[model samples]
Target chain A: MTLIMVVDDDLDLAEMLGIVLTGAGYEVDLVNRGDEVMPLFSTQNPDLILLDVMLPGLSGVEVCKLIREKSMVPIVMLSAKDDKQDVVAGLEAGADDYMVKPFDPAELVARMKVRLRRSGGEVNSDLTIGNIVIDQIEHSIIRDGRIIALTRLEFDLLVALAKEPGRVFSREELLSQVWGYRPATDTRLVNVHIQRLRSKVEIDPENPAIILTVRGVGYKAGVPGSFQ
Target chain B: MNSPFKAWRTSLVIRVTGTIVLLSIILIYLAGSALYTQISSGIFDEKLNLSISDAQSTARNAQFQLTFSQYQDKAALKSIFAEILAVPPKTFDNTAREVAIFSFAKTKVRFKFSGASNFLEVTSIPKDFRKKTKISNTTQWGRAKLSYINGRNEPAIVVGHTLKIAGAGNYEFYVLFSLEQQTRTMALILNYLWLTGIALTFLIGIITFFVLRRLISPIRDAARVAEELTAGNLELRMDINGEDEIARLGYSFNEMAVALQQQISRLENLSKLQQRFVADVSHELRTPLTTIRMASQVIYSARDIFEPKVARSAELLVSQIERFESLLRDLLEVSRFDAQAAVLEIGEVDLTALVKETIDYVHPSQDRIILLLAPITPVIVDIDPRRIKRILRNLISNAMDHRDGKNIEVQIKESENEVSIGVRDYGLGFTYTDKKLLFERFWRADTSRARSTGGTGLGLSIALEDAKLHQGEIDVWGERGRGAHFVLTIPKFAGGSIRSRPISAQPE
Candidate 1:
């Protein structure tokens, strides 16, 4: 059974989420306030986190940052605001994905399933893009013999791009393939995550050598020493 | 471009100034003519008086000298005449003196003594003056031309007198006075008058322009500051100097500005409060509504076990709640727009994909009657993706709802500065007047119709507002039974305005 921890400010919505998740064959642990999230989080070690952006004690973005400091937990932000700032801020704060208010329950579960699934797991391999070496098995990037930190979404984005180095990945392609999004899902998600990835892997983010942008198209991996 | 002359044609200041200049020119011309006539008459009067006196004295002296000669021989008379003529006529510089003695036409003479004495050339007198002098033998004086033997001309006054000589019989004596000095003086006076008049007029024009501009500067500044204040720069105020009437006006205007600022800020605070209340109500209601939705869905899942009527009621309840939720969302969005708090997060995206997605969302069935059209390459544009998606979604969904089982065509086109998407539906179209009210909130094409498949009724209005936010436009055209077309034109890049609409409302 999949254990999903749901943190929300409203008691009834938390209970409702628990009911909905339980009915979907998932064990749900309901937490009402944001401050109570970590204590329950450590012991339970839920596979996924359904966090609300606006909370009474600590904001969902802050909790996401705190959780990101310790583990690579898959965190999904639940927000009433579909506004870009809130969504991007949550993503930048280390949320894997987000769902706006009044979202369908079935869709939410499908998003969670996508977040928890691991890629390149059956066959552990090391991938290199530009100067950075990506260890899929270890879930880390080594550049200049130093390990760099990356959010889960950024890691997935990089892995997806690196796996198909020859293919030119358009924003829509990255969105659908990596983010598990349908067409017309906000393209800002792919762009923000790509920027986050470059800052982590590339020697100079201002002049990205790892993810080379194709003019009038999308992005592709740099050919060997083309960056030089 | 407005022509400079045409710009002045409608200006009150130019018209008034032109009228003033024309009237002053007319009045000045009248005064100048009168002054010229008076000066000329006075000068001629002084000239005539001096000329007549000088001529009379010379004539008397010549007659006395001739009468005193006793020998009466021609030689003696001629010598006396020469002596009398040798005394040049004492006259002003402008007066030329000349003397002519002519015997009466009927006067006889001694055979050897017919020599007549004339002191000056007869050509010194004008032919016209000589004709009048010939007609009237009495002493006469008038202005005439005096021409010397050298052919020099001077305006002169001729005064003639008749004398009777002892042996020579009747004689005519005349004096011609030159008016050269008077003419020079009159020319100098005319030059001075012209310079003075021109200088005075120029001075008046300059002084008037500056004085009028000085008086008008405060008003112009007041108008500028007032315009700035109206533009919402409430801190603006007219620059005040010494406490003249204009300064007093500034003081009063500042007072009004303060009042206006206070009133506007007060109203602004009130509006903010109202918006906050609406947002709070929406948030507070939505949380509970979400719980209700979940509960109702759970109940709806097990509806097969319940009675048919109860199951139908449960289904209806679920659908109505979803409708209520969409309405609440739209209302909140509209309120946010009203507060001018809507923000854009811009990114580059292919609009082709967005349109396809919207069509799928509207009609999930594979046999959708809608057609998606695009260019060979991606129609990429920079914009706030979420807003564009919402707009596209609203327009496509509305088309599908009204398509009335007919095919719908969605077209995408682009230009350098703008992009347009036209959604054409071959459905029950609208009337001419319906287009005007199409974007009104909660308006329906037919009131008797059912709620139209879970629409919030604010979709088109919200779409229009969204388009307006991006400095875009949504053009609509519809006929009774022909079809309906809606085209949304936006700039190709964020923060740009649409200059060329790739597609128009008219059918291709």
Candidate 2:
């Protein structure tokens, strides 16, 4: 059984989330303060984290950074304010996804399922994009005999692009494919995550080679052997 | 810089200075001419008096000499007459004196002789003056021009007397005094008068310009400070100098600025507090509302195992909770607008697709109640998709509420700089008078009718505000039991103004 960690300052909301997650057949651990997340995180090592933006001891953005420093566990932030600054800050701090307050319980469960599932299970062969090689089975990418680490979300995004090298994926399409979101929603998630992925994988993040951007359309995988 | 004509119209300083200079020029010209005439006439009168007296003494001397010689022989009389005619012409040290003797025109005398002194033309004395001298006896005098044989003329005063020569008949003795000296003096005085007049006029102009500028500077400073204050620099104040009228103006202006700044900051603080209170209330309600929502959903999902009435209660609870959540959301949005904290997340989007998406979201049923009319090509515009979609959803939902089972039409049109979406329905529309109240928060068309759709009553108000945030306008047309049309027009580009409407509110 997959275990999930829930961090929020509101006791009733945390307990309610516990009830919803447990009802969905996932074991749940509820933490009240943002500062208490790491101590429990190291002990339990949950499959995913449901973090709230406002907490007693620390902010959700700081907690997310702490988690990223040590682990690659998927984090989905819960924000009460739908302000761009809060949302973008959480994403920049390495949160995989976020849902505004009062979101549907069914939708939260669906998104958690997508995050927890192992992606690219059917693709047995290695995929080549630019000078990088994507090892689907090992869930990693190698460039010039060096392994590059990526988060699960980033890995899923890359595999989705590398699977069909010739096709261009719009932000909405990628959101639906990788993040399991419906179309015509916030595209900022794709933009922020793409930057993060490039910072980790590309030689120079200023000019990307592996994930080529198509203006007014979306992004696509670069041609093989295109960049020295 | 403004044109001179525009400045004359707008600037008090320019207008006042120009008028003052023009009036001064006219006054100086009039006064200068009057002074010139008085001084010139005074000098001429003095010169004429002196010339007449001098000529009178000389005439008396010549008459006595001629009388004294009359008792002698005719030769002695001739010598006396010759000596009278030999009076010296004008010299540098003496007044210009010329003597001319003429016999009376009707006199019958033995030695009738007409002679003039020293190359002086005998016709130098005007015939009219000679005729007056012949008739008058007491030192007859008039003005004349003394002409020399060399073609030179001089303005002179001619004094005449009748001399009784014993041998010769009555002779007209005239002495001419040249007025050239007096004429030169008048010319010099006129030149001085002209220079003084021009200099005085110029000085008046310069003085008026400087004085007006000095007086208007304080007012100009006040205007500049007022502009700065209006531009939100509330700290600006006028500079005051000595205790004068202008200084009083500065003091009052500063006082007004201080008062205005206080009032504005007070209002700002009051609104800020109000916004903070509203924000806190809404945000504080969200936590428990979320918990209640999830709890209600849990109970709703398990309603099948409960009794019928209890299950129905659970469904109602969930639905009402959803409604409450939506109301809170709308209240927050309205408060944001009131605080002027709303912002746009601008992007380029195909407006036709956006409208279609909203229509489908609002009415997902396949009953074919909503029909969309748009061009084949995509109408791409820079806008906030979320807000535009909200506006469209509100308009379409409103149409559906009063549609009366009739088909609704949603038309999308675009101009070069503007895009508009119009929702038209053939249903129980509102009265024309109710158009103003349509956008009022929580206003209902019919208070007696049941709100079956469970709307929050803030939809249309929020929609109008959202359109306004995009620099757009919402126009409506309606009639009793006829139909309704709501059109929203906005600029196609961000920060652009609407130049033309793609769709009008009045249906054709």
Candidate 3:
């Protein structure tokens, strides 16, 4: 069974989330304070983390960074404030996705399912995008005969791009495809994640080649075997 | 040159200085001419008096010599006349004087003598002046141009007197004093007067310019500071130094700035606090709302196991909660606009595609209600898509509410700088006066009618605010039972103003 960790300072809301997640057939671990997340997270080794931006002991963004330093677990942040700066700050701290407060429980569960799904059962396990080769079975990318580690979200994003080499995917399409979001919403998520992905994969992140951006459209995978 | 003319037209200092210089020039010219005329006329009068007196004495000497001399025939008389004429012309230091003698026409003597010194032309004296001199008998003088045989001319005072001789007939004696010296003096004086006048005028102009500029500098500073203040530099102020009138102006200006800045900052603080309170309220309410929402959903999921009435109540609870949540969202948006805190998240978007997507989102049915008119190619514009989409959704939903089962027409048009989206409904239209109150929050056309749709009542107001944030506008046209048209015009670029709206609210 997949396990999920929920972190929030508000005990009632955390408990409520626990009840909802358990009802959704996922085993749940509830942590009230942001500072207490790591110890329980290490022991539980949950598949995903549900973090609240405001916490008592430590801020959610700081905790997010600390978690990112140690693991590649998917994190979806819950923010009470929908200010652009707050949302952007949470995303920049290495969160995979974010939902404003008072979100529908069914929708939250749907997003968590997308984040927890394993990339398996592909017809072709190996794919080439530009000079990088994505090994789906191994769940890694090989660049210049060396393996490059990527978070599961980045991996899914890259695979989605490589799956259709010639297709240009809009930000909305990528959000629905990679993040399982319905009723296409904010594009900042796709923008920030693209930057983060380029920083990890591209030789020169300033000018990206592996995932080329199409002006006024979206992004596309660079042709295989092309030298930049 | 054009820029300077524009500056002259706009700047107070330049205009004042130019006017002062022009007036000073006119005044200096008048005074200089008056002074020149006085000095020149006085010099000519003094020279005329001296010439007449000198000719009187010479004419008396010649008459006495002719009366005392003894002459028997015309030869002795000629010798006597030659001796008298042998007196040398006056030297240059005294004045360039010449003498001429002519026998009277009525003389009875046979031998008539006529001679002039220095080759002076006899015709140099005017006939009118000669006649006056002959009739007056005393020395008479007038101004004349003394001409010589060599075609040289000098301004002179010609004096004449009648001479009596013993044997020779009556003769006319004349003395001409050259006025070249006086003319040169007058010319030099005139040059000095002109130089002084011009220099004085220039000096006055420079002085006035500097003085006025000095006086106006503080005012200019105040103007510049005012501009900066208007441009949002509230800290700017005039620099005050002393206690003169101008300095007092500076002090007062600075005081006004301080007061204005303090008032603005106070208002800004109050606005910020209000925004903070609104944000805090929204945030605090959201957490509990999430909990309640989840609790309701949990109960809603288990509604099938409950009584029919309870089940129905659960369904209503769920739907009303959704409505309440939207109302809260709209309230927060309204407060944000009130605090002027709304910001644009700009991006390049294909407007036609966005419009089509919005139409699909608002009305998913295939009843052919909305007919879209758009360009063949995509219309790309820079805008905050989220806000724009919200505005479109509001307008389209408004039309849908009043569409009265008739087909709705949605059109998109573009200009060089702006793009417009229009939604027209052919349904139960509003009154001409109702258009004014349409964008008001919570305003309904018919308060008696039960609204079938779940509108927050703040949708149109929020849409208007959203358009204003983009420096855009929404115009409404409606009449009783004639349907309604709503058009939103926005700039194609961020921070650009709409010009020449491609779609007008009034339909053709």
What is the C-alpha lDDT profile of model 3 across B372-395, one tens digit per residue?
999999999999999999999999
**Candidate 2 chain B, poorest ten consecutive residues by summed lDDT:** B68-77
The alpha-carbon lDDT assigned to residue B316 of candidate 3 equals 92
Predicted complex 3: CAPRI docking category: high
Tens-place lDDT digits, model 1, residues A1-228: 789999998888999999989998899999988898988889999999999998878899999999988887889998876666889999888787888777777778788877877775875778888777889989888887998987677788888878878789988888888878877666667777777777767778899888988865788987555656
Interface DockQ per candidate? 0.50, 0.70, 0.89
Tens-digit lDDT track for model 2 on A132-179?
999989988999999988889998999889889979998889999999
Give all candidates' CA lDDT scores: 0.80, 0.89, 0.89
User: How do the residues B107-208 of candidate 1 rate in per-residue lDDT, one tens digit apiece?
Assistant: 564312222223344666556665566567677887777665556677777787777677667666676766777887788877777777667666666666
The Cα error of candidate 2 at residue B361, in Å, is: 2.9
TM-score of each: 0.86, 0.87, 0.95
- iRMSD, model 3, in Å: 0.5
TM-score computed on alpha carbons, candidate 2: 0.87
Candidate 1 vs 3: which has more lDDT: 3
Between candidates 2 and 3, the TM-score winner? 3
Return the DockQ of model 2: 0.70
- Best model number under TM-score: 3
